[model samples]
Target chain A: MDTKTDLLSHHISQQFNNELEELRNNLLSMGGQVEKQVSDAIEALINADSEGAISVCEKDTDINAMELTIDEECSRILARRQPAASDLRLVLACTKASTDLERIGDEAAKIARFAISLTEQGEAPKGYIEARHIGNHVRQMVQDALNAFARFDADLALAVAKEDKSVDREYKSATRELVTYMMEDPRSITRVLNIMWVLRSLERIGDHARNIAEYVIYLVKGKDVRHIGIKRIQAEVFDQ
Target chain B: MDTKTDLLSHHISQQFNNELEELRNNLLSMGGQVEKQVSDAIEALINADSEGAISVCEKDTDINAMELTIDEECSRILARRQPAASDLRLVLACTKASTDLERIGDEAAKIARFAISLTEQGEAPKGYIEARHIGNHVRQMVQDALNAFARFDADLALAVAKEDKSVDREYKSATRELVTYMMEDPRSITRVLNIMWVLRSLERIGDHARNIAEYVIYLVKGKDVRHIGIKRIQAEVFDQ
Candidate 1:
């Protein structure tokens, strides 16, 4: 076998293999934390739980710290092990995925801030219903994407990538509905805008999830599926 | 000098040095394209120029293509050259900065899409002024961040990071103003929401620029300044 194929199929060194496994474990840990944060942030909005929202904001620092730590580990592995081919791809994917996880944390924090604002204003409005629906969908995407990464399941990753379109459609519809409500009664604009921002954050969270899924596909298939149309990705994944 | 320091201070190989330079140049090209896209997108919104906005959308594919190319080059260098120390840091930073630049392109496209929607609906509203102001500031941040990357100037990177705070403030004021305007005239809610999305896009672009600046700091000082408080970053940069 070629050196790269050998490296991929067999461990170059036991310590190096352990390091790679540790990196993946760290990423999964960070992903799990972010998923919980997203769910909690959405719950805070739906239940108008300002205290819960504040606690979510407080948790973001820990998530951010985890990202930095994972990133440092990736850099150290690249420098020390000098991994090639598939190993290099795995390290690169970990680095990129951690960055996305951190941003997902930021999006969840934004949602929490909105929840706090909505609570201060008064009762959560009708828009909270739509926010909850979209938020749930996004949280699922994050979970599935992480699962796909854990298993190196290209099929699951492609599925997660495809789900982003429905989230976008839901977000657009929600925005339209919220805008109509605001036009009917201008006094509700402030509250509606808060919900709108929450939906926007959910939509972005979905995007980040899709990015992670794309990274998973890259890692498994040795292909860069980013920027490619979903149709093409589907074709490639199915063909494989 | 020690081996690591010597590697940092001298080229590992002439070809590797050229490849690194090529990566930076590619990033700068992507940055320049994104800067123009941002400017054009804002101008389209302010002037109600749907055609200009559509053109900006068309140009995004090129930026995405550039990002993929640079990313491949970085991966290739990592697998082949196995660069360590500062060199490895540089490649990692490029990989990240290219991702940010591509997302900045995505943000610009979102702005351009908003401009198109506003044109179809009616005349641009007062919020366009705020959007243009914020857009200009964000574009400048992208430029300054790219300049910092080009020169490896940690001071300029820190400055760019600090500038993000003002952009955030401006974004908040703009959102508040738009909401108030919508409250005053319910009929304007649709147009006002469009402008608000544009402002949100600008704010996100500022965040990406700040991220690039952080990468520059990391590249120069071997410090991962991400997630640290700006106050700490300021102290660190100045103390050096």
Candidate 2:
């Protein structure tokens, strides 16, 4: 997939253009790895595949490396090219987006680690359905967030932000049910708590995806749409 | 407090140096706000002070706004001055640090939310002592991290990293004990889970503080010390 967002507005210096282009591509590359890590981690948890989970853990280093590389490129471009206006926003967004992606990757590794630990103690009585349901939603959110960045689509990014609300709702409801189940059966608390942590990680992944989307909105619209509600973001970003 | 870090060295442009200086000071100011939020949130939890918790929640917006403002200034300095070498690292570090401080503020708000929830549900049978213990430790870690950035002290930053290990250990042991308590007394699971979440928030706060400290190491030592273990960061960073 071509990762260039075409957000760059044709620089005179071909070298500078290439530097900006490479920065966006590298960020998307990191995003792809993170999206896969999240997907594989959820799969590992559902299937009780410890090896799969460990592999997810191992691949995290690559994502971390990608973040450092992309961040360095951002600084390099800022220092060398002194990019202004749209170009500066792109660099700033890439720097912030890479951090968000790395965090999403970290959360995925955490879910995978939970999978490994869960495998050791054997499967639980409940919560895999909740995991799969919320897992698919969050995975899509992460993927869509990256796509939003790749295409520079604030509308799609807005959709990602809106989906986070639903994902969070599902997470809270699932945790409440699990808490009730634990109260009914004391033996299941530990395993259920592990599942709860997985749910928590999934919820957090959705949040980081929302963050990336927010950065995209800022990139394209040049507005900081955070802390404001969806209605305000809608009115602010698209209206202008 | 003077937040310059004195790490800028001798830049030719006094205005550029002032911009860098203001960025650092603004970041430290944001950090100060975050530190207070965490402390207040923990205090609210221990005292069941809903008003105090609500204040922490309210103050979060200010921190969030501060993050955007400082981030904007970082880009401004990057674009206008196009600082290189140590100046470039300072800008990058400021960008990353603001994000960490914003996240730390988010975690504090989360803890405050938990505090408010716990107030509605009434106090749990266990976990307050643990909250007090880990809360103070994490609060100290946040302060030390900001100081490390302010002073450009890698040694102090390393100490913050090491302290995180102990904080995690304390957190894990507390959660384990709480888990045991919940299992033994099934009725306490809900309240205990709330306290557990407060601990989770505290743990994440420690992680963010450690991240800020790691960025300090990078700014001072010009090394990316993430994912590497403590001893590795210790030897690689301080060896020179």
Candidate 3:
């Protein structure tokens, strides 16, 4: 290539790199916001703190805006830079991951809404114990998934996917226990239903975390592991 | 530009157009499959067809695979074509829309699982009538959202968003009725809970449809209407 063309190419590449970095930073910030939302919302639920729950709901708009900003950045990079191979995959993964993050924010808001409702009704029930346990697990999954994305660690991502199985088990057992509790005492049915919705939201947060992990795997390995069994994902990551 | 360069540009544009068309067709086909899944699952629930529910669960794998395929195609085109402005928006919208469609499939599977559970227990209860009503509304929303996507109709997309408000109202009323039934007759708590879950899945289906409609608006008007109120969305779309 000519000197002028070579210089131009270097300049474009630098600009593209800067754009990719900005996208990553924006995504990480969004991930952090989502993690805080999940934690705060769950804490509010466990403590029956309506004030905290209200704050979580209020922050959802910021999360939504962050998603749009990251999306626009991804689109801009795709259009202007035309990044190939890994760069393209990174941008795509960022875009997809932002969607999961936004949805996670939504789930957090759902939990917060339930928390507010429960607070209005007065006093926490025993069912929140199970929710707290599951909430911790799901929150960790979200944290690890975001870390995995930040480091582009396929192994960590695969581990996150495997961790979801335990969350599912926890969710199911919790649901069953709650059902039995409700069946025994008709008076607690309404309260238990609210707790059930909170559990459902936590379970969905786990699913979104798993999705984020899958995106990490895709970004790192360029293989789609979504909808595949955990054992297969294990084999794919370990055997490599 | 020289004739050769002009011709090359035209050829590239043609190839990009063809890829976009293929992506659209693939998306439409996936939409059709998802529509079938939602319909069949709800039908199975209404008819107490365990066999149909099992089939719906089985078909989820196919829908998931289709999503990955479309995702890969979108990434490939974005890398190769670097489509700008509206074309880039279309590709991004496709990727986002496919994610919603896949989740809708997941919700359908959840409903089918409930259907299977309900079938194993006993005959259909009166609460399922409410489920059927909401299910039909959710299914119509999905159909209209997909149609809006296919035709790139921002107006139709806006309408879908507005229609979701009614679905929300229907879901709320249905849940209240179910909860009352559960409270009134504790003997039917388990069965009623199952129906409640089905209704929740149906409500989520409507949410996904709304997300798809928002994507349609974004693709057509280059505005992000997510997390915005309906009045603002109307003003944004119509005031222009």
lDDT by residue for model 1 over A25-143, one digit each (tens)? Answer: 99999999999999999998888899999999999999999999999999999998898878888899999999999999999999999999999999768687888899999999999
Q: After superposition, how far is residue B174 of candidate 3 from its true place, in Å?
A: 0.6
* Model 2 chain B weakest lDDT span, ten residues long: B1-10
Between prediction 1 and prediction 2, which has the larger DockQ? 1
* Runs in model 3 lying further than 4 Å from the true structure: A1-12, B1-12
Per-residue lDDT of B1-240 in model 1, one digit per residue for the tens?
Answer: 242243244784778777877877888888999889989988888888999999999999999999999999999989888888788888999999999999999999999999999999986686877887899999999999999887788899999999999999999998888777878888877787778888988999999999999999888888889888799998878776
Deviation (Å) of A138 in candidate 3? 0.6
Residue B60 of model 1, lDDT score: 97
Top candidate on lDDT is 2
lDDT of every predicted structure (CA atoms)? 0.89, 0.90, 0.88
Ranking by lDDT: 2, 1, 3
Model 3, B1-240: lDDT tens per residue? 342232123444677767888898899899999999999999999999999999999999999999999998998888778788777888889999999999999999999999999999896765788888898998999999999888778899999999999999998998888888888988889999999999999999999999999998888788989888899998878865
Give per-residue CA lDDT, model 3, range A18-111, as digits (tens): 6777788899999999999999999998877899999999999999999989988888788778888778888989999999999999999999
**What tens digits encode model 2's per-residue C-alpha lDDT throughout A34-108?**
999999999999999999999999999999899888887887788778888889999989999998999999999
What's model 3's overall lDDT?
A: 0.88
